[model samples]
Target chain A: MADELLEVTDLTMRFGGLRAVDALSFVARRGEITAVIGPNGAGKTTVFNCITGFYRPTGGGVLLTHADGARFALQRLPGHRIARRARVARTFQNIRLFAGMTVLENLLVAQHNTLMAATGFGILAVLGLSRYPVAERQAIERAREWLDAIGLTERADDPAGALPYGAQRRLEIARAMCIDPVLLCLDEPAAGLNPRESDELNRLLLRIRADGCSILLIEHDMGVVMRISDHIIVLDHGRKISDGTPEQVRADPHVIAAYLGEGDEDEVPAEEVVA
Target chain B: MKSALRDAVLSALVALRPVPVAIAVAAVFVGRLLLLAWRGRSRAAARHANRAFAERLTQAGKYVAPLLLIVALAVPLSGDRYYLHLGILVMTYVMLGWGLNIVVGLAGLLDLGYVAFYAVGAYSYAIISTTYGLGFWTCLPIAGILAAIWGIMLGFPVLRLRGDYLAIVTLAFGEIIRIVITNWVSLTNGPNGISGIPRPTLFGLKFTPAGGPGSFSDFFHLPPSPTWRAVYLYYVILVLALLTNWVTLRLRRLPLGRAWEALREDEVACRSLGINVTVTKLTAFAIGALFGGFAGAFFATRQAFVSPESFTFIESAIVLSIVVLGGLGSQLGVALAALVMIGGFEVFRALADYRMLVFGAALVLIMVLRPRGLVAGRTPTVALGRKREISAELVAQGRG
Candidate 1:
């Protein structure tokens, strides 16, 4: 309980007659990579949406505990405040970079609150009276560091939309990291990456985890989910079917059935079916 | 290609029966030749051409600003009252275009009711100065603040809307303000209009012919002339317009301006990055109205009258067109657009009955040729290394 970074209890989201996520409960420990994977419509994204404050769950609580033991009920906060106050950052299933803005600007926008405060909400900066120049230089320096980390340093001035698909995916993660989030929620980060790019992503994500930030990932790529995730939560029909370490969840009968369909599970191993 | 050219020429001929036929034919032929040249190029070659054009535009822009400033400063020396009046009008529209650019261009909020604020500013100056006997200098800031409050009032209800829906609400707001000024008899005089507004003075020195203790002629010991008043008013509006432009340019480099462009690019992304969308939108609206109010105050003092007829839906449409035709967020483009639109309107006065038709045709032609307006490229606010001008193709035209 002391190591728990996020605690989602009885999370329920209903759209009229359909239950997108029903009474799903899970806990992501501090500084660990927790993967949430399921079949096409197993409500994996719904769980993420609820945690990120994109969709207010019909009934439930999302409690995030900061390192200093500060508690924030994510659902009660507004969308932007979830990122600002709760330090929860997320990337969309479909990439949503400020495609028109330059790579550096995209990262700078992530640190908007910090610079805004330093600039006295624009008054001081306009009047050339604040500590904004120093703050801006530091912000740009941090952006350059991330750009280097993602191998996008040369293209820092180019529009984010102009980057290759794999690079864009990496940049999205880098943008998310720029916020210095306590928790990073990625929705299907490895969706369309090639094998080589996927491998690179594994290293980048590992680097992020090693930096002491907790990760909550929704990935369909079994290779990525199984390889990097220290803990895994499997969902079926908006309910948690399996929750354990990678091997334990991989060997569960319910997770296999959810992926491969019911009653033919004995013929093929879960690895081939899920992967 | 030949058939398409023929069709274009045929349409132009049909549309311009009142004008000279040779001019229309020449225009079509030149357009066709350019299109053919463009189509014959390879993809790489086309991209090269685009880059070269953008570079040349930038090169020219560096010199154009100073040149234009010199020309503007010399207009008062010409001693032509008509040209001075025209300069004042163009500068007013330029200020309006820049103000609206913050909303519809940068923040991407379509505001069709901008003139409502303009009307509020004019009325504030008119009623306050007339009733309270305050000078223009004293009433100017009050007018701006009052308009900003009205801006905030309008911003609240329309915060949830976007695109066409937002445009409709703002359009209705413009009409509502006009209707209010029309019917509010006790306050606005109910369409009878307000007149005899005071002219601006030089530090309390009235521009009067009779030499006295508080007259401009007496203070300077110069012969009094009516042209001096026109020249002074021209310089006043010039300073105000420049201030608007300078402040806008400075804001673009700050966090607030970047947030506006980011909001335009994608509102959902702005929220995900911890940007307060409500405050950003309201600030853009309020700031834009503040400038509009300043221009309105100037207009009241210049004309010495305030009327509901002057602040109509057409005025809003014209200002919005100037922003669009000026290529949205580009400050230089907006100023150029105001010059062309306002100045060209006067230039076509000889045609009398056909002036509107010619103006409409010219607008259509410009839209067809340059879909992104005159200056389509964007300069990035901040850069990690050498700053690059974003190509027009890469810039996102906000939902407006």
Candidate 2:
């Protein structure tokens, strides 16, 4: 039962001759905000995909060891299995809500598989069967709770697509919470947010950590990262260039040159060469 | 088609059957009113839920109440032979529509050769019962097995193909089966069609030979009743239709069902969630075809003949249409769509040559009117206890 929630080791993914993510390793601690930041094609999202099981890695392993010392080989797990089995939940850069369904249904559906287990195939659930009502009530309660938290209770019955961009982002978070994830991975959650919305998002993130949740977020906003992240990992062209606290990363010349823009279009880092 | 409408109207005149479903609906309304009253008296949360319900009631009543009124009108209207038979055909499509809905609509798997499984079931029954002298009851299981197998077989190659291409391949597969059935006369009697196929006896009665012990005529002591056998056929189909509903409702609530909806929304997300999209997709295909096969077998037996003409591409389109019109992933909606489309088409057969034109125009109108279909899906509006209404205050608290 250690505090290390996720461990990624030597993870690499290749596309033709290009290595999208090459030899990257990091440990995300439990109950903390771990920010992965790099320039536009830094393979940050790609790393998230590999760890969450969207893509099979070409090398290395991802071991998600819960507090109980239960090690889940995320590299071995497929995408959906990673979510359900490893309690790993994620949101996409592009919102992917069920367009045809109402907003409430989308969240309820995130808890779809589990409800079946509780309802025993919904035979009881639909029939108002034993303990089925309890589960159904609990699910509604959870969905309602999240909707309230996201300030979407008023629009609960509206189609998910009808929600404003900011609300949709919140709905996605609420939907992910409905799955009751152990580790939540967010890819650019603050990308399109206005200043006020981003501030609200920061509060939400802090509250999430307070409620005993671990978050791994990929962000471009240095202010948000430096303000909220307990740990920061910087990548450049699929390689982990720096891993440390925000202040440490901000101070590192390698990050300044590779990530913060230097005359390095032709220069390779000495540390990368040494490694 | 006019003849079919006549039959339905004449039949209505002959018999006024009690509609159990209509009564059940009325009962539900009464229960809801009582619920609304209980909700109004409770906590503030209950009142909010009640308000939502009151709003929903008005919106739904505008559409549903009219439809119910039309169905009620049919009770007093009887039908003649042709219209009655068309009525039966409409019922068959309801079954097929419901079947296809589970796969295409619910699971979001585009299956083009859906009719192929229907063919498998039909021919399995046709060749098995006629060739081996098996009884109607005996061939049903074999029909289901063969159809399911064909479904799985069709599922494999296309599991890799998606979207429009998947649709064409499936459509091609359905055509391939039909062509084989037409060319291979030795097995299917080719395009000549299988005739003298035995009707399914109730127990051991022969309907044609009226004096037989278990024939409808013998059982009812009616004199050589042709309509009696037809009525029996209708009930058989009704039972099968009910069974299909029960099974689908059961399946959709399972983990497999949830996996299916997930696959439909985002396959990548589904995989991320650890759902095996391949297995989920295939199971849907297999099960959907199984029902299609069951319906096809029943069609073959009821007609007492089999032919490629019955299993056409248009049939698949019609089934798909019903699913779309009903609203995807909504069981009750799909069934309602089937009843309306098939039933409405049959009722307007008096217009004959103009029927398709009118039907086409109506379809266009529907597309414009309720593009989501007549029975657009409505999610269960959640609310506080006994009140059954969503409490705004409660929801706000849930957000964090």
Model 2 CA deviation exceeding 4 Å by range = A1-3, A119-131, A264-275, B1-79, B131-138, B183-189, B203-206, B209-211, B245-259, B325-400
lDDT per residue as tens, model 1, B208-257: 65657778887888887778788999999999999889888988888889
Residue-pair clashes per prediction, in order, are 0, 40
How many backbone overlaps does candidate 2 show? 40
What's the C-alpha lDDT at position B93 in model 2? 82
Q: Rate the local accuracy (lDDT) of all candidates.
A: 0.86, 0.73
Which residue runs does candidate 1 get wrong by more than 4 Å? A263-275, B1-55, B209-212
Score chain B of each candidate by TM-score. Answer: 0.88, 0.76
True contacts kept of each: 0.69, 0.28
| Candidate 1 backbone collisions, by pair | none
**Candidate 1, CAPRI quality class derived from DockQ:** medium
